[model samples]
Target chain A: MTKVKVAINGYGTIGKRVADAVALQDDMEIIGIAKTRPNFETVMAKDKGFNVYTLADRVGAMEKEGIEVSGTVEEMIKAADVVVDCTPGKVGATNKDLYEKAGIKAIWQGGEAHTLTGCSFNAETNYDEALGKDFVRVVSCNTTGLCRVLSPLDKEFGVKKARVTLLRRAADPGDIKTGPINAIVPNPIKLPSHHGPDVKTVIPNIDIATTAVKLPTTLMHLHTINLELEKECTAEDVESVLAEQSRVRFVGQGITSTAEIMELAKDLGRSRGDMWENCIWNESITMYEGELYFFQAIHQESDVIPENIDAIRAMMELESDASRSIEITNKTMGI
Target chain B: MTKVKVAINGYGTIGKRVADAVALQDDMEIIGIAKTRPNFETVMAKDKGFNVYTLADRVGAMEKEGIEVSGTVEEMIKAADVVVDCTPGKVGATNKDLYEKAGIKAIWQGGEAHTLTGCSFNAETNYDEALGKDFVRVVSCNTTGLCRVLSPLDKEFGVKKARVTLLRRAADPGDIKTGPINAIVPNPIKLPSHHGPDVKTVIPNIDIATTAVKLPTTLMHLHTINLELEKECTAEDVESVLAEQSRVRFVGQGITSTAEIMELAKDLGRSRGDMWENCIWNESITMYEGELYFFQAIHQESDVIPENIDAIRAMMELESDASRSIEITNKTMGI
Candidate 1:
């Protein structure tokens, strides 16, 4: 099988993880990784044997700063079959025109607005919608977490509505600048807080509302979800459905918090201690009458990595089936 | 004002906090605090000038261990106006016979089945229901949290149904034994998990379901609540109602997690960093169509402390009105 050449733009938190995940896939290869600055991550990317590329404008500056670069981002984009844009939110929107001019399939991160890609992608929720698309935006970590659980539940029993409270990590572990030093801050200070609308970009028909609160921790984002189902079901019934999904891992007894889940990822020797699966507490699956409730933890740094890889297969039509693509991604990334 | 004599029958997590809260009330006095062991808590109770009483069976054993005691649990029960049973779960059930025999009004913690007192109490939710009741059970921390928000929402807008996901702290900060060391464990591994039925013991007419999972942290429990309201409301509308309740503290921007809430309590010079109010993230208050959603932190150690104090007021008819009792308790404890 001919390997799909993939280029990653913006080698930051989500970008670097995607680069590593794409490296493990048998059908895809990381052709190059692009960044604007010659920072520590540029050095780390080079050490990982990834061909480092700089933005067209910053190529000279990067080389001047003693950073080795193989080529410019434009060169990488032109060479690859697909360009995954992991740039900062608004920057991804700016790069859309560049990928289009190169006639390359593009995958954008959730940080960008949905209009940038025209569709939000989740392997479990909207794999079919993304198949053969020229551009796809992998949903945010929280959205991916929600879709991973909601898609199955919505399919099995049918969702009347879903309400999710996102206990978000204030900043990424590596991010020391931004805070919530001594408080829980609401980002938008409004209802639905963009997450619910983001979910709709993939599962357009589902009735869902999300409220988010940023917390002090940097480990993981915990989601407490309540889904009102169309039909009455038992907790066992819901648990079994979620367990069948490849991307959903049922965390049973003894593992209590996001800290433990991250520790387990490290103990298992996962790359950067990234837990790609949605860590759903198995015992937390509860159903009363027709209402179902559970708590799941999202590894903010890595959950989207798997989805990005799946989006590559999805956009390329290398795997049109979600389960097959998810299986392959999980097996390769050890999700 | 004639002071109401209150005896606490457990010097553990909930018991210890309630003892200090009772000590703060001008209308109430901590007559005694009972313990079965001569542990650190017993010594701490004595240092706080609370008369330390020993369980009837362990009085001799406690004395032999060089622990000074004021009297036996039996004598404390006879002299007190109300005996608050904060013992271990089943132990409260056993102590019920003693309180009944002594003809003293009794208050039980949520750990004991609601049947022990046949009336679960929350100052904000069922303060009127508990007035003049011989036996009152102060609902669990999580239940008190749900009621603090739900009671007002239900009354103001009429909740059609409420579904709550409780991200529970695995154990108390002082508790070193109970886990989840490395996993998120569901306490009951079943639907509703006793919390829903416990809420019914206080608010019988409201349709609510609760699912609980234990996390590794000892900070506080986070509750993600979804309420299907009877009529459409705005986020501001919901926020205004929650802010009106004395036990519900609206956590606005700059506060991100329970850790910060606890720190704020300490900075405010609260005893043991006790935040008696349910710290609801004001930014998290959201209403879409007719459904309302929000995230709130329940201080598992001290949330029920105020509820216990109000239960004392209700059981004694010293303050039959919940608002009056809650106001007094909040002002006294600086909630």
Candidate 2:
């Protein structure tokens, strides 16, 4: 099997994780990583025997760390089959032209979505739509979790409108200038938070509305949702349907909490290992009389990693079949 | 005219604020305040020439905080024609026995509602129902704001089922611990917070459901509400109607903010100046194509402060007509 050659354009936290993931996946190979300047991730990737490139400086930071580089960003994309643009906001839009020039298929991370030409996707929600697509925006971790849970629920039970309250952890501790570490910056889970509603605009059947508040925590997004179901159903019925998904679990408790789910992650070896995966601990989707309430913990780094990986492979046409994409995603998640 | 004697049992932040308000009202008199230990509020009230009573000795610093003082929680009920219970959780219930035994008309705050023998009461929403009634639990601030807004909207445009996500500012920064300041206490507003189905237990023709989260802020509670209206209506109509409210200012501009309203309040010479007593910044009640998306900031301290004052005067039989209650409320608010 030909190796999937890839170049990570942004070497930030998520990008670094992506580079490592590509290197570890059997069907993938890292071509090189492009950095505005040298960062620890680039150094680490270089140490792992991958090419590291600094387009801004012909003289790379590998010298400071006593390592060698191989190519420019142009060379990196020219050599790779897929380009992952994980650069920050508008920076990705500017770098996207570089990938397009090389004719390399691109997988734009959450930040680059608005600038991309193709669909915003969660593999579970819209994988088939992603097939044969040249560029795809991986949904943000919170939306990915929501789409994963809500898509099936929307299909099983007709959804009218959903009111979502996301208790979001800080993207990082220093995200604020001087606000309380305790202040909750209420916004949607996704960028331009209301864009999640716009994504629903593309679909004819679903109407999902979300509101999020950032609490002082990292590692997970907890959502308290009220679903306007088309018909009446019990919490058990909702739980049973979600529990069937290999990637999804039913915590079987009322009102899934972040602490409860976090502890579950600790119990599940996430604290020791498997920290990258979604540690959905308290996953009960309790339906009260007619509304549904549940809490979920999604690892911002890894729960969506498999989907990002899957999008790359599908864009490259290495996994062209719809069933193949689903199979690979489920297999990667070990569902 | 005889002074309508009133005594506050819990001389904390709210208790003191209430006492200050009572001292300002001409017909009402603060007979005395009963407390477990002499706190700063008690000392300040005394310094201001109001009578104060210490039910027990100061536990001292550590003992001074969170420690209960020994004495009769029931004595306040005997000391006044109308007693206000400002104690925490179960203690409020414990004091309820005193009010009932003394056969004095009593006013209970929302926290004491769990032990309330009856229903949630909002001065605007169910003030008429409270006439000639004793043992009223003033809905929590968040609930009070929500119920007040919903009452007008529901009466004008019948609602199917309403949902609200309360982003409440902490009473102040220090409100998190045993708080005079309640910061970032998620869902601190409580469940079915104010808007529950069949509110007829307290008032008739009301069926609404709500939930809340407390953010680190003071001065306002911002409610992001989604209501399913029985009849289709334009956002302008709803905006015009809500704008018509003397107490509700439709403060929603392009990007609605609670800070704007707080500034308005300050400009208006409110204690700190919060606009409209409570500011509802939602531009519309109806959605882009479906549902309602709007935000309202309810002044926890003031919006209900005037209402609480009115309820006190009316409960004490100082006013025969409730319209006079509105006048007294407006007069105290200086509107």
TM-score of each: 0.83, 0.85
Task: Give model 1's docking category.
Answer: acceptable
lDDT of each: 0.83, 0.63
Q: Residue-wise lDDT of candidate 2 within A1-335, one digit each (tens)? A: 88988888887766776776676577888888877665566667777787877674655555666657676778788998888887876677777677778887887766655446558777667766777777788867766777777787888887776677666666542245533343334343122246456446225367766665555455456565678789778777877777765566544243234445545656666422333434333333455546776545566656666777778767766776655765665565443
Report the C-alpha lDDT of model 2 over B179-290, residue by residue, as the tens digit. 2131223352223444354244444555566655544455466666777778788888788767765566655443334555655667767653534355654433446545
lDDT of 1 by residue, B1-335 (tens): 88999999989988898898899899999999999889888889988999989867888888887888899999899889999888988878888788889999999888888877778888877788888999888888888888788878889999998877677777777788986544434455555667877778888898987766666567788877778898678888888887777777877657767777888889889888888888887877766676677778888888888888888998899986778888888888886
Q: Name the top DockQ candidate.
A: 1
Q: Which ten residues in a row are the worst by lDDT in model 2 chain B?
A: B180-189
State, as a TM-score between 0 and 1, how close model 1 is to the true structure.
0.83
Give each prediction's root-mean-square deviation over alpha carbons: 4.3, 4.5
Residues A1-335 of candidate 1: C-alpha lDDT, one tens digit per residue: 99999999989999999998899999999999999898899989988999999866887888887888898888999899999898988789888789889999999888888988788988888899998999888999999999888888889999998877777777788888986543444455556678988888888899987767665567888877778898778888888898898878877656767877888889989989888889988777766566677778899899999889989998899997888998899888876
